[model samples]
Target: MPVPGGSGREFNYPDVGAGRDDVSPAGYRSLEMVRELGTGDQIFDAASRRLFGWQMHRAAGIRLARSTPPPAPGVDVRLEWGVGPIRASAWCRVVDVVDEPDRRGFAYGTLAGHPESGEETFLVERDTDARVTARITAFSRPARWYTRLAGPLGRLVQRRITQRYLDGIADDQW
Candidate 1:
């Protein structure tokens, strides 16, 4: 797909978010790239001890630490694509933890995980507000020239898979 303004850069700052002219522009791109390749919205309720977001693409069931509060290390995560035996491993952390900006109802955490593919993250922006939306934009590059031919095909598959997964994640769930 062509980027707006004909930049042709797959990573669109505003489109995927994480692009901040104010701070960490490069870092934001890197983080956004990770999210682009996997799940980008996550929620972990320490009290509940359940890691949600696995039902969607790049989502995984992880075991969290009760003593360390929510989003602690050693949280096992499994992310996958295409129904194969292919999977990746990683963990989540509340990198930019903060309270609800609008002061509504819920708190949120941006959990980052890697399924061994490279790196991935789930970006759940709002918890206090019921209006929320999430999408998985996992990315990959085929090996060898012949394999490159399948890039378009791969993107098609990814889009279809992500859309279906998004159907399960509701506005409030994000």
Candidate 2:
């Protein structure tokens, strides 16, 4: 079966790929995070590789239940968190991929089963100074009752995970 609320199909939320734009859609929470990973082409390349390969999610303690390698547009990915029976799963589809001379990353939109309805973009950029920076942008709103109940806690968790994504690139242990 096809993923519900997916790209070319349907998204759980409207304004698909809004995360990449400067304006956040109305009635949704917006997030933008930037962190300097390091300097040089080597670090930029490594960070890009990790982000595309899903290593950032792994490093952030999220289980990559399934994903299409290299994260191309239309690719589906299932991510899980928590443990055992308590595990929560989020399904999404890659809506767009950034492959520019100075930037590399992709954006995925929430599917039907996702707790939140929206899109998130991850980009690794290298400036003229060769300083590598990681940027994560997202716009979302709770889709499930539990997430809605989470209220402020949900935002906190999202921020924490976003930080871990940057830390994953900065640390580069893997």
lDDT of each: 0.30, 0.86
Structural similarity to truth (TM-score) of each candidate:
0.36, 0.91
Model 1 global lDDT (CA atoms, 0 to 1): 0.30
Winning model by TM-score = 2
Candidate 1, residue 79: Cα displacement in angstroms equals: 3.8
Q: Write the per-residue lDDT of candidate 2 for residues 86-164, one digit (tens) a residue.
A: 9877788888999998999999888886899998899999999999999999999999999999999999999999999
Could you tell me the lDDT of residue 154 within candidate 1? 51
Question: Which residue segments of model 1 deviate by more than 4 Å?
Answer: 1-53, 58-76, 80-120, 127-130, 135-140, 143-149, 171-174
By summed lDDT, the worst window of 10 consecutive residues in model 1 runs over 102-111
